[model samples]
Target: MTVPGYRNVPAQEWDPAAPADPAEAEEFLRLCYTEVSRLGPVEPRLAVVRAQIAATGTYVHTTDELVWGARVAWRNASRCIGRLYWRSLTVLDRRRVHTADEIFRLLVRHLQVAGGGSAIRPVISIFAPARPGRPYARVWNEQLIRYAGYRTEEGVVGDPRYVPFTDAMRAMGWPGRGGPFDVLPIVVEVPGESPRLFELPEKAVVEVPIAHPELGWFERLGLRWHAVPAISNMRLRIGGVDYPLAPFNGWYMGTEIGARNLADPDRYNLLPVVAHGLGLDTSHEATLWRDRALVELNRAVLWSFHRAGMKISDHHTESERFLAHMRNEEKAGRPVPADWTWIVPPMSGGATPVFHRYYHEADQRPNFYLDSEAAALARGAGVRPALAAAPLAA
Candidate 1:
């Protein structure tokens, strides 16, 4: 059965060996400059870019160009329902740093900066772009913060979705605490170096303990989740250049945790547990026990986050905001590229405003993409064999 938002749509393959296309650079620059009038005309900038691409294989993006390009990349993210605030993304330029230790340090800072206060700001830290025919540094973790999953004798402990990944980390000498919510170490790999594991300090990770507003026993379940959903492995492509290690984040919508992460059968699979706790009859589907449990679980997630003073949005409110974003984009005479499967909320599809409309589907450039190889690595494929020969680095 095809999952609602987790469709296996293939991303357009990127050839790392190929030089940056001057035409793509021109197209992006023209749009970028045209949108922001204060940046002035694109003619002079285009001339320099063309000349540089002719001489060298690629042209460097100026700070202004990089900033605008990152924001536009967020704007062009088709799967994201929160693109209404794309312009408000905090772009951290980390193009100069390359070492694993420094990169790890900055990543911790990125989380603190993003989730330190109650207001979780949307942030992206763009690392060095992949030069032509050159390997670039990247984080192996799909998201910067995820709990470790351990497969034991009886069944899987913690999140079953990450069991393979957790096993791979253990193979690489990460002594994972066999606990439900142990934060997995960040594996950073630079060119010509072994992937090193860096444990996230307690201060770097902001977590909200899950508890229903009224269910007193819900706290005993000991469920919690990280605040920031920073996707670390997706390649951030912008203006003909690809930043393989640009980790970006936005505050989570309640349903993402309640309906998908915690409730998915393959993940935490909390529906049955919650239903049992609620004393609902699960002997028949006609009882609608799962639906009742899902609603209550989602309510708990939203309530917990709100009580913690963390920024979170409900699926209903976010759907309305997405429609507002589409209207705003329409006024600008721009097409809003979106996937119908993703734009609609996974839990209540018929109830949301975005569910009723068809959207333009386009592979717009200056966007983020999950390369197949990166996805494989994130899921713990090719890890044991690749790192088996190399000694674990500090």
Candidate 2:
């Protein structure tokens, strides 16, 4: 969904059955108290949540806390380059939801709302949290919108990163049309059931077909990307509480699509293809073919999204905004934790402001995290095999 560091982090060994980390939970409550109290006394509500945490070893966030916590989580996401707009996140509280079907339905709405028309908005939908005895629901899509990867004799077709997950979906009985640009269906798994694949309604998805302003051949590559980058598989861990089904999105920074997704060898791997198309000298490492193609792909992504009237930002502008965000956080006496490798754009890193400075890498709480189990699930491993055949929800 989100790259681990992007939507992924190194897998931290954790027992799903273990109780909430008391110290972490307490710290989270303190944060909630401090933030919520700034609005009003709200001491009574805080007292109740505290008492519940004491009794049950867990507690529910009030509507205000959930909303604020989600926003704060974005602010605390170490790898996000778009933290400049953290406070603008729209939180949709669906913590009551536990079923695969309902989550699928809400995800459709999330896509429609976030990517509907050309109005790109940042939104997060928080679903049920993982507790001591209950298994949390999980979405298998690394992102809400992704192309299906089909394994062929010639090699993997489509996005290679998702080939395993795509196979897993097919094995689970999803009838996805195998094509290079086919939008993968959303697969949701509950603790006790088979993962269900829900097809995204076409109308809800807005895609930008890649085309270069000068290179006419670019459009013939048949490459297209979804306008919204809704990360669906990661957990939003706040105050020691784990919400495993919080799917959040922001508009893309052109480099993410152009440099990483489309150019990375493990992904669409289009650099060599584009370089060949451009008739570049690929004989030597110094030809800078990769660098040149990367720039063109990034250019095409920005142009395509712009032409389609979808929201997108160039790496240069995003990097500048991130610096402004850092200054603002400093003014507020908050240390912004950032991963320099991730904060800088994938292409032309040295040219961006973010690449010139060091950042605090200390992790902050109320941030999105990816666990080993969720990572495996995203790879298309069946839940029944992994969870000892937990009963499927009928």
- Among the numbered candidates, top lDDT falls to 1
Each model's Cα RMSD = 2.4, 3.6
Shift in Å, residue 107, candidate 2? 0.6
To one decimal, what is the Cα RMSD in angstroms of model 1 from the true structure? 2.4
Model 2 agreement with the true structure over 214-305: per-residue lDDT tens digits: 99999898888989899988888887788888999999999899999999999999999999999999999798888888888889999998
lDDT of 1 at 201: 90
Off by over 4 Å in 2: 1-11, 36-38, 42-46, 383-394
Native-referenced Cα lDDT, model 1: 0.91
Clashes of 2: 12
Q: Write the per-residue lDDT of candidate 1 for residues 1-394, one digit (tens) a residue.
A: 3322235656768899889999999999999899889999899999999999898889999998899999988888889999999999999999999999999999999999999899999999999999999998999899999988999997888999899999988888887889988888898999988888888899999999999999999989999999899999999988898899999999999999999999999999999999999999999999999999999999999999999999999999999999999999999999988888888998988999999988887778789988888989899985866675444444
Model 1: CA > 4 A from native: 1-7, 385-394
